[model samples]
Target chain A: MRDIFDQIRKRMQPPQWASWQTLIFLSIFSAATAALTSQAPPQIAERIISSLGWVFLILGTWWFVYEPDVKKKLKIYELFIGPWIVGALICIYLFGTWEGRAIPAPTAFVSWPPISAIVWSIPKFIQSDPKTKSPIYTTPTPANRQNIILVLLANLLISCWFQLYFEVQDWLAEYPSFRAQGFEQSAFVRELQPPEKRLELSRGVDYLDAAEKALKSQLEGKPWAEVERWLSNLDQEFPTVRDEAFAQLSRVAENQLWNLNARVISDAYDLEMRAIWQGPSARTAEYSLTKTCRISQARQVSTPEQLKFNSPTPPALSAQQIRSLGTVQCGAASSPDSLPQP
Target chain B: MFTDVLPLRAILFQLLFIVLAIAIESIVLQKYLGIGQKTSIQYAATANLASTVVGWLVFFTAESSLPPSWRVQLIGYIFYDRINSPALLIGLAFSIFIGTFLLKVQTINWLDQILGIRKPSTVEVQDPIKFRGRTAHRQTFSELPNRALGVLWANAASFSAITFLIAVRTILPPTNY
Candidate 1:
């Protein structure tokens, strides 16, 4: 490690200060890149110049944070942590920052921009000496190696933890019904969301919308006779409709966690589809959301004359008896203590 | 340098999951398959690694063969944590469960075949002329009672435990798992 750093240091000697030519080159690079990527000049110039200035400030602070240009034992953070901070700041400024998604989440505690600077300043306050001059040529000792290894391991562990957090986020995003469940009995996860604020972002309504759209597209604009015939074999036909509706669901995932089933509430009057969530929950009980759909004669009358043609081909089905969704209603989330669990 | 070449995060996660699965499956195999603790652990590790290796191989093969749109989705899901479609995720999850179970069964049988049978002696003779008459015997395979079913139960238990851990992690701090 010592030999590697030594070689790197010898090969990559940074100038003591930014020269005029280097500054001009950086400015032109930033300008060209910004102009190529952005349509708005002012905003582009502002963001690009601001980021460049901040990067400069970060590197500047890193160099001058030490007490004097003298022989002093520099800690690891003082020597190397600036790049990490600058990287974080660049990532945030370039890509974006996000609002916390989980309960009791720490947004930037582990990855804030100024953390390196703060950490680097600590040794400066404690170990600063006026007599010290700029000769940091300490040989790598066993204790030094041990210290470096410990810091590396600690950083690795923190990165692994962040990766785990990302993994959980993936699971939750892919399987969002898990978010609806209670976590009181869980051993690994604990929810800190207040009781009153729970279930505020329930995806029940969105799921119902999908189910409703599927119901109308599948059965709404058909003959009443065909509708009755389909309802007659609800056992077989209901499953097809359920699959279609569930397929249309963009809520979380398909055929997993959330269960969608439909039955004729009133064969000719309305159809009721129930979406039961079979996912991890914070609550002890499960909830089912329902949506009711009906055919409306009024909507078909408003259809353009293009519908009268039905198909460019000779169609066998009734084209004139077009039906549209009417009085569609989605019920609130209700725990099905009495209803059979899907 | 090493970190750039290898996915350190993924390795960390895989080792953790493998360890957890191995611990649980070992216990399950010991009680149900009637194996000694050490043998159970060895079998579980072998089976888990076999399934994991096969899974990664399948992933790479599919990634290379799939279309650009699908490749994007797979890459995004794996690297960016972007679940483009729930159907893909659910199907992948279901396939992994079934695939792991079947793979573990075959691997456990293979491991059992090796470990359960006593290997023929190495047949080392310091004096080749003195031991000229000696012959080495062939090795044999051993059969375990209810090996497939035992692996099934163990697989199911470990999968459930892992799913539960993932579920619980939704509300967890970034400390344990």
Candidate 2:
């Protein structure tokens, strides 16, 4: 274990070729892969790109820097990484513009320009070292510079294409509304009735409108007196026409009353109601009502023994009859006793 | 002293590096750029001449059968193939050339540093190897090819493998319902 540890320790120390150039190469590769995987739309693309970058970076570094015999070979590999990186960018641009649908202009602006500038400057930086008065400027020759410029122009075209694609997609997804006048004209042709017919149909609209307004106002948290008064006024206004209107109004009122009953039932079941009715008298009232129905049904049963036992029975009753009697009788008998003594 | 012609080991190492570099570059680009794996492989391969012609042939053959989107995707792959893969080959060649020159310089520097050899200002030691000799003299940096043909072949092989894989994936019948 100690020997293995020692070997590992020895390996950690970087060799001669482990300079700023190698570090920058690794960093750039890392950044590129991160950007690709992190920003790429499809999940599969992201994973593949990230894994490939990692595997290549490690292999390239190991081949060039670690293995003594392959040092020269590795250096050659490093040189290729730059151009290949440029190629990758071009591919990204082409795919995005042609196949990937649209290139997001903002993303291209954010990611590509800086990356291009950095990559373009690398050869120049490497060529000009302060220590060496004239370091060899190997890459960024006039020909390479021309290629870079071409790539940049291609990227710009692709970016514009992407923006246009997104705009089209947005247009396709938009909902047609009144503001979309052309869309409204085409889609809602049936909704646009003839103006004279529309006006004729709405001729008696003012009376109906007035009735609706009065009903709405009378219904707004007022006593039944105000509603009755409004109904009477409506009747006086058009005695012959008022019957049908009143019938319709009555149906609406019935629906509202049913809804109110439902709300009251719900409120009774609420915690607030339980707290309000927490007294012994309320509990007794509830119990008696439940019990009275059972007693009344027991009396109504036509068993010979029960009939013989209650020879003076008041009346025979069905289950529903017993329930109704229980409700009426229980309320009448219990209300006074159940009320607060004060 | 004349050495044996450039060692096979050196060539093999160079080829290995070329493959490794391209694979890494392709993977990185695919992972980050949201490009398809198939596209990345194609790009990695056709960046150089030996592979580009083959890639173009494959592309044109596939183009008629594929949808417009796929064709566009293929174009992207081809573009990357032309740029990154070939550039990598060129970079590798340059690095090899530079590394060799640096090694020679370092050797001379080491001798002077360790042996305390005083320079006789009168005479300069000329490089033993010269152009057009039995010994392979290193070419002046200017004379090296802009791109490496050997690296291109390596890329072509990788591209072929990738294209084959894509074809196999597409052609094979589904096993599951």
Candidate 3:
């Protein structure tokens, strides 16, 4: 409606500009804050610090620059948008910028640094009068429109600069191999050594080294527990490497002198365990080797339609109850004397 | 997927999007609202400008902030892996339509009041003696249906504009999405 346009025009026409000193200071502070926070680890402390910095920067800038009448506009803005900004900051803190395992991804676009440019520039745009001699808010001029647009463009550019830089920094952090390769290396140069080959070679070396160490320690008569612990300690494994590592460890355990092979059988939703000794062909004496085994959810074999593997312990066995309910007929042992179990 | 270099093309695309949106809304307003072309154009431009800036700003902010998992989920919901989900797209379109309709009505009412553009109405006394000359106006009631229809047309136009913008953005050179 004409009336709505008139009202808006009236409100915006005689825009007062914040002092140049305040504008300059605020812009510098915002960029600095963004740069600092980008360099810092994505932690709650950093989020909180950046948010508080923005909140104070806006308030402090307004206090130093604007007249009392103009300051009321800032108050209005604060009243309307303040709580949401703070809430967003709190959420950003709670959900640190990480990939998997974070609480439902909280958006960070409304955070302090990204929004600071617009918020700070709004008053500056309103107050700016480039046509005037001193550029102070004395009277509204026709050139005010052009000047305001310039100020807004400046604000947008400054804000975007911070955002782009921060984004690049985030990208660098996410891909640490870029750092390892060194920034001096061009993309074409880097492409000369394929990433897939690099990964394969590195993983191959790691696997060989780990296998050698485990086998040597085992030959020295280290307990099976030590080997198991060492295998488990290979954390931060890529999926392919993890599977390969697990397979290698299993092979080492199987080739041991006092080896125990355990089979987990699930029949009609009932789980049964059976152990067989496959080493030493001539032992007449019976030996019961107590072995501790880990039950992991089988990724390759299990499907949703079949028995689920989410539970840490099987359903057929209670925590306190341990009864060998299922019959386990031992296979013909290498020595007939050790084949007494049923 | 963005090249992480010259984003001039993206800004150009955004400008084209805004111009297209304004044109679509203006045409709808002229045809359905039964308003003059000039007034319709003015209204369309104002409304589109306000909404587009706010909408794109919020959208970019959310896009930049979303985690990979959430982004994947959102992409799945909206595009269904490029097969497209009509249900989701329509739902989003309708939501935006309703929001825009309400905002337009409020702005129009305010503008009319400020410009002293009230429609003249006869005041018919409902009950002269008991209700102290309480009156009723029939003009507003009669005009309601026409206004509602006009708004519905506006909604359709807006939906089309949004869909076009989405398609263009999707088909364009990839951003850092």
lDDT of each: 0.55, 0.35, 0.42
The structural similarity of chain B in model 1 to the true chain B, as TM-score, is: 0.75
How many backbone clashes does every candidate have?
11, 19, 7
lDDT of 2 by residue, B9-51 (tens): 2223334544664585466545543456754444343232222
TM-score of 2: 0.21
State the iRMSD of every prediction, in order shown. 13.8, 32.4, 16.1
Better of 1 and 2 by lDDT: 1
Say which prediction, candidate 1 or candidate 2, comes out ahead on TM-score. 1
Each candidate: fraction of true contacts kept?
0.00, 0.00, 0.00
Off by over 4 Å in 1: A1-55, A68-136, A190-205, A216-227, A251-255, A264-272, A277-330, A337-342, B1-177
Q: How well is each residue in A1-342 modelled by candidate 3, as lDDT tens digits?
A: 999999987765534455534544555565566556655455565556566555555554444435555445547645334323443444354444536544323235324433443444354334545676344544324244333333343334433433443443443333222222222112111122333232221122233334333333332333334433433443322233324434564233222222222222332211111222232211223322221223222113222332445766664553333222212122111222223458
Each candidate's B-chain TM-score, in sequence, is 0.75, 0.26, 0.56
lDDT of 3: 0.42
Docking class of 3: incorrect
lDDT of each residue in A1-342, candidate 1, tens digit only: 999999987655545445333443454556566555655645866576657755554444444433253214434645554435544544454444455332222334334333433443333324333478544444344333333333443343454445445444554465544444433333333334424433433465566676666666666556656766666776787776667766666754423656777776763556677777654333434567666665433345434444556556454344355554333434544334324548
Task: Give the alpha carbon lDDT tens digit for every residue of A33-119 in model 2.
Answer: 667565646667666655565555544543444345544443564443343344345345433343345543335533454354445
Q: TM-scores of all models?
A: 0.41, 0.21, 0.35
